[model samples]
Target: MKNIRNFCIIAHIDHGKSTLADRLLEYTKTIKITEGQMLDDMDLERERGITIKSHAIQMEYTYNGEKYILNLIDTPGHVDFSYEVSRSIAACEGALLVVDASQGVQAQTISNLYMALEHDLEIIPVMNKCDMDSAMPDEVEDEIIDLLGCKREDIIRASGKTGMGVEDILKAVVERIPCPTGDENAPLQALIFDSVFNSFRGIIAYFKVENGVIRTGDHVKFFNTGKEYDADEVGVLKMDMVPRKELRTGDVGYIISGIKSSREVKVGDTITHVDRPCAEAIAGFEEVKPMVFAGLYPIEADDYENLRASLEKLQLNDASLTFQPESSLALGFGFRCGFLGLLHMEIIQERLDREFDMSVITTVPNVSYMVYDKQGGVQEVHNPGGMPDPTLIDRIEEPYIDASIITTTDYIGPIMTLCLGKRGELVRQDYISGNRVELHYKMPLGEIVIDFYDKLKSISKGYASFDYHQAGFRPSKLVKLDILLNGESVDALSTLTHFDNAYDLGRKMCEKLKELIPRQQFEIAIQAAIGSKIIARETIKAVRKDVTAKCYGGDVSRKRKLLEKQKRGKKRMKQIGTVEVPQKAFLAVLKLD
Candidate 1:
């Protein structure tokens, strides 16, 4: 254990975390470099050019004529996948804080840095992309010094593309980061930081052993689930799972117990010997809090059970996703799913389609709210349809967030305008270094959950980085806006909006739906209403059959009779016709400007 080092790579999105990881793997000769971003093996990850999952691999390096075992966990840098970074941090003793040479310290860089510090992990700062034309290593070096308080020489300037300074990074990992420390004689105590489902192998759990030894064929139990199973196999992860006789203290490896169900395993659970268990489960395991909520209904009602099964298996891989059974008046049986943010929600939908072959309809996304009744009873509402009658409610409070935006000084005006338009209150502002400024705002989570980040990037010319956390709720003038099709309320199309935005939001919803919902045989009236009052309305003209066409060149009275008969027929058809809201109509709300 004294010759082992466990560390992870941390940085902002697209800041070369995976590229740097590739260079490290190549330098260690762990595997042949056949493709770029070998760590991001998923099709979606490569297609989107983002890392959706954290990958861990073991490598052996020689330094000063001594062989050292190194385990590197490459982490995702996007804010939506921050939970993955936290889990990776829990399994390692050190982190490589990579900052792009051009785009110094970003919002996610600082946020992830704080997470590492909270875990007391040794941090080694590395300036990547040093070979780029716009590389500003010295300026970024100063920025890193200001943020981390580390000396200039402590930072290693490297280029993942050219493999420049890659050797120095490995040397720093050995010299600066401390070795994994624990007692091997103690009872078995291993933390299951991550796990994945395998079709033939059942479920494979990857863990880090903190104490004692785990041998193949040993009986083990997960503390969280309190379930026991036989360890069918145990081994170290090196690109491929390498079978081992036993895994001792300070070792990262995978265990296969022939578990058949995904529900049997939980991430962050403790693994202990069934005969000689540890004192207690590992403490300080953080639960993920979902920030945005939306309805996910299978396109076919019979697919409900299949959808649930897929979600359960997907949750095994992604612990951040949460869902509960729910039924919508328009969409039939479905689940009300909670996500981290807009991007997280989109990724979940795409994964369901690509990974599970499940077709689903996602309703308008919103944040949870607190509703207090006249009797002083408080209830939390995730869907607008579950809200109590407004007459019996005392007040409604919506979720808010403390938003931080890091950008150059030039885009401050447009950024402020965008925030103010969303009813954001300025909390404070400070200068980080040079022309870079950090602005903090207290904004409603509902306001920014949709397209605020996209707008921020657009206005800042892709230079602004944003991050936020939920703040406590405060009472506000809120009303539930219900969308009615042909005068019948559609529960799946309703949403809760602040009173000041109710009319405008209602009108926008009406206008957007008009363009997405296909026109029916009879005229369809789309109305947005709050209780008994209609706030906005739109009409989709029917494909008129023109009963008068046959009466052309006929007597005036005959044409009038034909038109009146057609009008009566239309009125009768409107009463019995039901509107089918296409999936595009449900998704159009997300793109509302």
Candidate 2:
């Protein structure tokens, strides 16, 4: 226990967290240098050049002739996976706070720093990519000291690419971070931070042994679910899985209990020995709740079963992902899936396409709204199709977010304008450095759920970063903006918007749809309406045909007869024809300028 140091690396996206982890693995000889960054084994992660999940590995290092067992938990940097980072932090005693020398402190960096502080972890501020010509180590150091209140000499500067200060980082972990505290002789208790399903071994749970020892053949029971299983194997994670006889206190490893279903072992669940259970379950364990909801439908109706099977397989490793069978009048059968954020939703869609070879369509994302009826009953509506009648709903409340944006001073005016346009309330603004500022706002989650991030990036010329968390629900005058094609409402195109901007937003959406939908034989009326009142309208005229030229020097009566027949056919078609709305029209609302 005295020679063990458990820590994780946290940083913003594009920072060198994974690269630094690779260097540490090579310096300790945990894996061959030629093997590269083996921790990020997923193909999606490699393809995107980002970490989507937290990974753990065990390493042995010798410092001053003392052997230390170092457990390194490498966490993702995206704001979408902040929950994963928090769980990783909970399983460690210290954190290596990595910051890019060129980018300095970003929105996600500040969010992650506060999370580490909340866990009371010892943070070793490390400045990475210091060898670049554009590196501003001095300015970044000042920023770190100002934010963390650390000593000037305590910060470690390193370059993951050249491995300039990798050895010193390892040494700092040994001397500065405290070892985990637990009694091996006490009742067996472990915290499950993550889990993955294997076809051969069944459910494999990655956990941290908080107290006592767990070995093969021990009966373990989950504290929350009250389900028991016999441990089939116990092991530590090197570059690969290495089976061990047992796992003891202060150790991070995986356990296989012959459990076949991934749903049986949930992340954040406590495990204890069946015969000698712990007196109380571990605190701070809560199930992950999704923030964004969207409908995912297979492009072809015959592929619905294929999409269902793919989702079930993907959910084995992602405990936060939730879905259920839902059908739409316009979209047919599909699943209404819930995700942590937009990135989470996009990653899942990409995985479904890449892994399962399935093509799917996604609807506009929405947030859960609380609807209070005239009878004083409150109901939560996850889908707009499930909303009660407008007259039945006395008042509606929508989810709000506490948003933080970090950007240069030059883009402040445009950023503020963008936020205010989205119904954002300015809470506060602070200057973190000479040119960088942090703007805080309380905005509706629905506003940011669409194209708010894209607009922010555009206005700031891709220099701004954003992070947000749910701030509960608030009363708002929101109305449903319904889109109509040829006098028929398209349910999939309906969205909730603030009452003040409904008319203008409706106008833009109608105009955008006009550009996306193809012209038909009859005039197509694209309209946006709130209740029975039409707020905006656009018309696509029918394409004209050269009936007279086709006559070819015929008599005037012949030309008139052909034209009369064409006109009659068009009028008849208008009475019986249905306009086929293109998929692009459904998504055009997101591109509204």
Candidate 3:
């Protein structure tokens, strides 16, 4: 077996984690023809520098004429996959922590570095973006030593974009990061970090060998679930693609364990020989949980089946994701989907929009709430639509989020002021990096439901970054304000809120909804209310001029098309007699500004 060096790259969002991986692939000939004629699958990865998923690749290089196999794992930088980050760190013995020299260290960087330390991995600090005009390598190195508590000589100055200092960085990996240590004679075992599906190849899993060697046609079993499968082929992820091959201990590789479905091979599951299984799997694996949830429904009700199939296919590769069919008394049918966080939710929405070509209306996300009934029975309610009747709800509790903000010292005042305005309680503030502070707060999830991040970025001029985790539920005065259109409660107009801001919140939401909803042939009454009391009301005046101007034979098709579109659009609108509430009205309420 070749001497293997297994490591992972971690950083905060937009810190050039994926860019560094691309540079490594190009330099190591994993993407070019100098080493081997192959093109890096840099289409999506290059366009979006964020590694939305965890992936690994292998390259062969001769350092001092001693050929070494470098197995590099690229991980997601967003806080949404904090759980996945833990698993990826566990799969490697060391990590190359990339920090933006221009921006310095971020909250997510500290968070991920702590996770790496918890796994007891050797951290090799690297300052990226050295090619930028504003980059400060010396300052970044000082911050790394001060904040990360690393030695002065441990940091590497490198720019992944210009191919500067990359060789030295790789050499440092070979010398400073120790080779994988495990019982090579032990039973074959590897931990699945991520997996995906192929049209002809069935399920493909990317894993890191923790012990022994795995060969093709070996009978293997998943340690946690006790599920067995025959190892169909061994492979490695190269150029953002999977190529089949044999892999050994200390090497990160792919195993198509004759498991036809990706659901069978889950992230963090250990693969071991069925006959000679390891005594125990490596520690630090944790279950992935969804943090944010929203209701997703097709603009057209007939696409429910297609929606279900799309969700099933999405889940095939993402076992941590959860979704279920849900229905509203007024909206008919929909699905409540769970996500790791806001970025995850955005990616899913973008995928659905780009891949499925479906028009979707997504409701505002809500964290699970606890309800204490008049009988003193506490029930967890994930969906606001499913919350018990307010009359029966003796006490309502809302979810609390532990939020951290990384920003320049100048914006600390505005950011913290905004946080306090949102009913956020200050926890602590620490200097994360030179001139950058980490503001920790416990805030109501409801406050951040809309454009809190956007406002933060705006105030900080896009310099601030935010990361948050659900702390738990806290008892609070909560109510579900149901918006009505012509005396009927619109199913999509429900918002879980505190009683204090119900009036103004409802007013602002209804105003935005009114603006979003297009004018109709008939007038629509948009009213926001608490129970039977109307707090805010707006009228969507009927169309004063909407008919086509020309109806000649040449313009007949165009005229008919316009008329047909209007009729179909009107049909999609929920009409209560003369009142017409367009579907976009429900959507606009979800969009704060």
Candidate 4:
């Protein structure tokens, strides 16, 4: 029990967290180096060079003839998967705060550090990528010490790529990070930080035993769901699955029952022995809530079942993902899916396309809105089409986020201008280093949901990094801007925008749509409206035919008759012709500058 050490690697994207994990595995001789970076099991992760999911492995090492059980969990660095990092932190007692020696501190680095602090975990600062030519170890060490208030000597300098100082990092973990302590005699209590579904074995729950013991054949129950099942198998995580007879207190392992459904065992749920159940559930085990919502429709309506199956299988691994059956008048039958952020949504869409072989059309992303009706009722709206009538709504509230952006001082003006345009309130700003600045703002989540990060990167020339978390809802003068094509409202093109910017946004959207929408036989009127009031409109002139071109040496009256007939035909077509809006037209509004 004294030799057990549980920790997780927390770092920003491309900070060498996964590489460091590989080096640690190699140093511990847990798995042969010939196997390569085995911890990143997902092919998508390997291709993208980003850890999309949190992974855990149990390794054993020997120092001074003393064997230590070192359990390390690797967390995703993107802001979208911060919840995974939080859950990983909850399962461990310490964290290896990995920072790039070249990049110094980044937006996600600060965001992840705060989360580790919130969990009260002991942080072991490690500077990685020291082999690079641009490495600035001394400056990065100062940044870490300043941010964490740790001693200079406490920071570990290591190169994950060249395997330099890897042994020292392992030794520091065993010495500085405390071992897990729990009572084996107490009731069985394990935290299900992650879970996945299996066809043959059913649900496999990965957990850290907080107290007591769990073994194969024991009857275990989920505290939140109150579902009981016999533990058919138990094991600790290695490079692969290895069965164990029992998992005692302070141990990280997996439990498998006959339960086939993934919904039965939820992440953040507590598992305990049915006979010796704990008096109360463990604290701080709230389920993750998605922050972004988007509609996904199958290109072929018949593939809806396949899409549904894919989502269900994906949900087994992604507990933060939520979805329900929904239909859009323009998009047909589809599922309204909820995600942590844009990256999460993108990853899910990619997986659906690659793994499931399904092509899907995604609507514009939106954040949940709280609508207060004049009848003293409140409703949550995830889609712009679901918003109540303007007359019945007293006020609307939208989700706000505390956004932190870190960049070079040169881009301050552009960053500030972009933030203000997004309705961001400048809360604070400070210099993290001689040349780096950290700008804090409170901005609507909706504004940030679409192209804000892209624009920020463009303005800063890719120097700025961004991180944000929900800051709850705030009252805002928001109105739904609906796009009308030839006097018909297109639900998929509707969006919620602040009243102040509605007119300008509507005008821009109309212009963009006009450019993307092809000209038809009749004139097409592209209009943007708030309720019944049209705020902006653009006209696409009808395609005309030269009926008088065939007239050869005709009298003036004959030419005039042919020209008049053509004009009348065009007027008739304009009165009755319906515009054929292509899919690109619907997506064009999403790319409005």
Reference-based TM-score of each model: 0.99, 0.94, 0.88, 0.93
Model 2 poorest ten-residue lDDT run: 582-591
lDDT per model vs. reference = 0.93, 0.89, 0.78, 0.89
**Which lDDT tens digits does candidate 1 get at residues 489-561?**
9898899888999999999999999998898889999999999999999999998887777765857999888
RMSD over all Cα atoms, model 1: 1.1
Clashes of 2: 0
User: Per-residue CA lDDT of candidate 4, range 1-593, in tens?
Assistant: 89999999999898999989999998888888775457777788988889998999988999889999999999999888988888898899999999999989899988898988887788999999999999999999989988999999998889988999899898999998888888889888899898877778877999999999898999989998999999999999997889999998899999888887666877888999888899887787567889899999998899999899889888978888999999988778999999998889989989898878988888888999999999899999999999987889999999999999999999999899999989999999999977999999999999988788889989998779999877899999998999898888988888888999899989998988888888887788899999999989999987877778877895889999988888888888777876766766655666777
TM-score of 2: 0.94
Candidate 4 local Cα displacement, residue 362, angstroms: 1.3
Candidate 2 residue lDDT tens string, 154-213: 999999999999999999999999999999999988999988877787778999999999
Q: How do the candidates rank by TM-score, highest first? A: 1, 2, 4, 3
Count of clashing residue pairs in every prediction: 0, 0, 0, 0
Model 1, poorest ten-residue lDDT window? Answer: 546-555
Off by over 4 Å in 1: 552-554
Q: List the residue pairs that clash in candidate 3.
A: none
Output the worst ten-in-a-row residue range by lDDT, candidate 4.
Answer: 580-589
lDDT string, candidate 3, 1-593, tens digits: 43678888999978877667777878787775342112223233345556666767788777998998888877878777676677678888889999999988877898898889888898899999899999988888888888777787778888877878789888988887888877678887788877777768777777888789887888889988788988887867666555455667787777775566545666788889988999888666877767678888887889998888777666666666788888876666989988877767777777676666766777767777889999979987778778887788889888889999988899998998899888999999987656888889999987886668778889899899888877888899887888876677776668788899788888897788778767766667788888778889998776744668656567568987888887766655535354445666665665655
Q: How many backbone clashes does candidate 1 have?
A: 0
What is the TM-score (0 to 1) of candidate 1? 0.99
